[model samples]
Target: MGHAADRRPGTRVDRMMTVPAAVSRSDRASATREAILNAAERLFAEEGLFAVSNRRVSEAAGQGNNAAVGYHFGTKTDLVRAIAHRHNGPIERTRARMVAEVGETDDTRAWLACMVRPVTDHLADLGRPTWFARFSVQAMADPGYHRLMAEESLSSSSLRRALHGLQASTPHLTREVGEERREMFRHLVLNVCAVRERELAEGEPTRWPTWDDTATGLIDALYGLMTAPMTPIGTIRR
Candidate 1:
């Protein structure tokens, strides 16, 4: 048997200390990563996504090592995806709840609300001075980064369900017209939200009083756009 002195609590205490030490390092790394993500999103939103550099992001994040971005996130595209993912989870949950509420409905406005409200609700939950809306617009506008945004968006099962519901509600639209209107809806929502986000960030008055109102306006406009009569291709003069 070991002597009492040899078996004293020193070894046990030392072992216990290791856990918190490891946790502290992990906490610090996570905090650093968050900082880098916030800085990168803001920079990307303010400047064009292609115009901003990883080194600039790191510097804005207050990292002394300019390579901190590259070390934490592999590439610019990876960093943008990470920023998107941070917000996507909450938005997805909200959309899932909305979809559940309006299950298998042919109501066009209901489907449009499901598609629009989740996003605006998320923005509202984020409070003012958010960068995500602007960052998303920048990503969607860029050819190189557009696919990344689309992939992240399509990965949401709730969004897919909402879109299917929308399509079913508007059976009058031919496949080509449906596709064209879908693009229009995407541009309208993103650009409108981006404008609202910029105005909020700049402390300027917004055209719509609230996010809910903005969502309502979008749904109304989309309903008109989707239900509009299609012009015959042959009737147009080239």
Candidate 2:
């Protein structure tokens, strides 16, 4: 009774009338931007990134305006970076919580899992027919876009904390070896995810049945690589 008494007559119509045309324009712009992003991601992943052009992305996105990608996202590098940011938000949130739970453990696998699970969980949540992992592999292959992805990835505070925790546990790990193994870890995780995604996309049977299992396999491999004794690279014995 009190709720009804407080409600003004024709309030809904008045509220609708109050919204400016600018709001609708903004919504349309945002929707167009998202469509462009989705189109670019799928094209880049499926057709090999270099083969696809901005005009292709515009056409695929259903934009009559050929300049949509540039207008919305600036350069191609920026477009790639924007896609990375879009996906990393939720992945970082889950990683932040996982890092808090693990909290400076001696367990190398735990630290790796802190880094690994959030990504797998995010992919799982996105379900089948995902392209971001493959898109990432494509980005990493290109020197220009690799820098963009690398810069965007390093911006995550949660990821930094997780890597720091891993670093703390690895006392015997030298700087050069750490850098080497870190690159290995990166390729292993990302390429494996890319391969699995490709398998799913192509209807080929994958060795692992689920993202969880794939993550576990990576954790094991990464844990082994991270813990393995470093072989000093003197000049190659030729």
Q: Candidates' lDDT values, in order?
A: 0.93, 0.88
- For candidate 2, the lDDT comes to 0.88
Error of 2 at 40 (Å): 0.5
Top TM-score prediction, candidate number: 1
> Per-prediction TM-score, please?
0.94, 0.89
Residue 161 lDDT, candidate 1, scale 0-100: 96
1-238 per-residue lDDT for model 1 (tens digits): 7655333346876658777988999999999999999999999999979999999999999999999999999899899999999999999999999999998789999999989999999999999789999999999999999999999999999999999999999999999999999999999999999999999999999999999999999999999998888887778746
Q: Give Cα distance to truth, residue 144, candidate 2, Å.
A: 0.8
Alpha-carbon deviation at 224 in model 1, angstroms = 0.5
**Model 1: pairs clashing at backbone N, Cα or C within 3 Å:** none
How much RMSD separates candidate 1 from the native structure?
2.8
Top model number, lDDT: 1
